[model samples]
Target chain A: MTGDGKFNIASEKHGESTVLRPEGDVDMSRSSTLRSALREALGDKPSRLVVDLAKVEYMDSSGLATLVEAARNARTQKVPLVLCGLTTKVRAVFEIARLHQFFEIADTASAAIEG
Target chain B: MADTKPHVYLELRSDPVYLSGARQLIASVAQRLGFDEMACSQIALAVDEALCNIIRHGYDRATDRPIWLSVWPGRKDGQDPGMLVVIEDEARQIDPTIIRGRELDDVRPGGLGVHIIKEVMDEVEYEAREPAGMRLTLYKRLVQKDDSQDADQAGASPAGSADQGRVSNDG
Candidate 1:
């Protein structure tokens, strides 16, 4: 589905893992697109899934909810989901929500895949 | 000296797409008021969350409903310079006592919007409008740590860009 002008998500293979790179604002409006992409990515059933948020400038609670749901699904499937390259602003949101301890995070996509 | 920047009142449709526009408007006003990049983003994010609450839970995702947003730079009660954001919606009256944000440790969705708003803004007030609906007012103090950093602030558009938005001195 087209994310309109809000954001873009592209899927690529990184070693044994599948990486979903989403760039732009991830608010309530663009979150459904991200959720759909995650669902499709998990359909591949990769051993590991990593979301690259390096280029994401903003993310609200809806965006956070999408990641949480994806992580839960991945856990049940025994696939690791790693989030990487969060901007300071986005990182702050996770911290404020006290969700930093719940999800696996890495400094880069490659680092996430390695771990 | 107290800040007396002109107030800008924006009336928008409850459409989710216009949310992006609202964030841009608040960010620009906050930046020009001397808020730093992070501060501006925080203010914008808080306002966005408030709008989301109105559009989703308040208006039941009705895109045609009306939402009112007002912004002005001023000093808070404690003498700190800040911006005031007032959002009004003619939707169902939410119980203010039961409107507490959920504990964050649960690791769930759907409840973080109000939590984020309270965390980012300095003061938050919710009031039932005169006859119906709810009014949410938020305040954020401007504290610039690095004034030299570039803020991705949107261009200042005169309060009225479309029927969705208009500027007025009196809120």
Candidate 2:
């Protein structure tokens, strides 16, 4: 995990897919860190990008917006983006904004990569 | 008995770094008022969104401006017990009527904060403050076991249509 004080991003490469696990509350103060990590991961041109959110207990709209931007970028680059392991609170934010309709979600990172 | 109306007051600069602190305060208050875990999370998220809007738009990304937050337990007089959060900002004031979340079909990075705030809170009110600023009041009522269905349905309103709050110019 690449640590930036309270927030950290653990990135791994699984064959052609890259999984980014962000730990800590993904709020406005820490979203830019996640955004930078996603940009770097996407820049590597992985065939599939999976974000694991099992450890994220809280996420504000800024974090959601960051992911939305990354989703758009991934789509434009033809990199399949999958989000997995969303906690109940994080999932509610997506559902509230009606963004659940826009992204591909999976129960786990392994499921995302294999399926 | 008179309503004590105990409340917590916080004053901070308009900086994103302080968002989490504000969220924690509101969430703790909501939980203390008997909101479930999910409801507490929702309340915190709504308050975070409101503060974000103030810092990003109202303060125009200036982090040094003043933002005041007041949180208290909801009134119990014929009303469901919950939590109430009022955020006051000394920044640029605009037409309260025009503050709204964007269309969901647009599919963009920004503009989702307002929608999240409206969706999570049971009541939202925006009024222009005197001189120059805005006051945003958000309320979330604790739901009884049998009333969960009604609360769910109320929060399930369509995105853009969730702008049912009162907006007035008091400046």
Candidate 3:
């Protein structure tokens, strides 16, 4: 992900892990892009998915809601999903929504992918 | 009508895609006004909420009227980049009495827009324009804090007067 709000997905299959970097404002307008990327990363029945948000410059409530919904969906499917590298601003959003406790949060991609 | 104009002016249709474009413009112009990223982000949030109200309830997805959004950046009262955002739309005439902000304990998915808008702006004003329409004016200090202190210390109101708010009939 970059400050320009463009994120990339670099998947690795070392043992069991998927990484997707999302940049830009993931509001109602660009939420579909994130959802599409997650769908591709999840692929089969259920797999562990790790999202990196270091490059995200802006994220509104709609964007936060999408991530929360995705987390719920992954849980229902028994797939482990983790979000890593959240900026302070992004982290504050999760706190405001009280969603920080609902999913696994990590400081780095390695932590999420390896955990 | 305030004769002064914003450094940048844009009119957006009542569409979701245009919301993102409006936010992007706010960020770019806000930054140039010497506003920190957080202050700019707060303004963007306020703008989004205002637009949301116009989309869902105001127009009801039935009418084809355009929303007029004007962003003003100036050094009023010697404060750097004091911004005034005026949003005028011919959507729905909202009654202030029924538009009370939802509480945090209420916890609804859709009704928080007004709450967020009021909380983020330094000063908020609403008026009924001539003919048939509404005008929502939001003012914010780019650098300095208002009399009530900072955003974190802003108080929520049962009647929505705990903060600097004004509603008038600008006939």
What is the docking quality class of candidate 1?
acceptable
Runs of candidate 1 with Cα error greater than 4 angstroms are B1-6, B75-80, B143-171
Ordered by lDDT, highest first, the candidates read: 2, 1, 3
Q: Best to worst by DockQ, what's the order?
A: 2, 1, 3
Model 1, residue A100: distance off in Å is: 1.4
Q: How is the predicted docking of candidate 2 categorized under the CAPRI scheme?
A: medium
Best by DockQ: 2
Query: Looking at model 1 chain B, which ten-residue stretch has the lowest summed lDDT?
Result: B157-166
lDDT of 1 by residue, A37-63 (tens): 999999999989999999898888899
Residue B9, candidate 1: how far off, in angstroms?
0.8
Q: DockQ of candidates 1 onward, in order? A: 0.37, 0.60, 0.18
- Candidate 3 lDDT over A1-115, as tens digits, reads 2222344444456466667788666765676677766676676543578888887776766666567667767877788889999887677555545556766999998888888
lDDT, candidate 2, A1-115, per-residue tens: 6676789999999999999999999988899999999999999999999999999998888898999999999999999999999988788788888888899999988999876
B-chain TM-score of model 2: 0.81
Give one digit per residue, the lDDT tens place, for model 1 in B48-134: 998888888998898999998887675423365568888888999977878878987688767998887887777889999978889
What residue runs in model 3 are displaced by over 4 Å at the alpha carbon? A1-14, A39-43, A95-98, A101-103, B1-7, B60-65, B74-81, B100-112, B125-130, B143-171
In terms of lDDT, the poorest run of 10 residues in model 3 chain A is A1-10
lDDT of 2 by residue, B1-171 (tens): 245444788999988888888888877776666766667777788888888888888888899999988876675243546677888998888888998878988988888888888877878889999877999988776555566566456774432223222111220
Model 3's CAPRI class is incorrect
Query: Which scores better on TM-score, 2 or 3?
Result: 2
- Give fnat, all candidates: 0.76, 0.78, 0.12
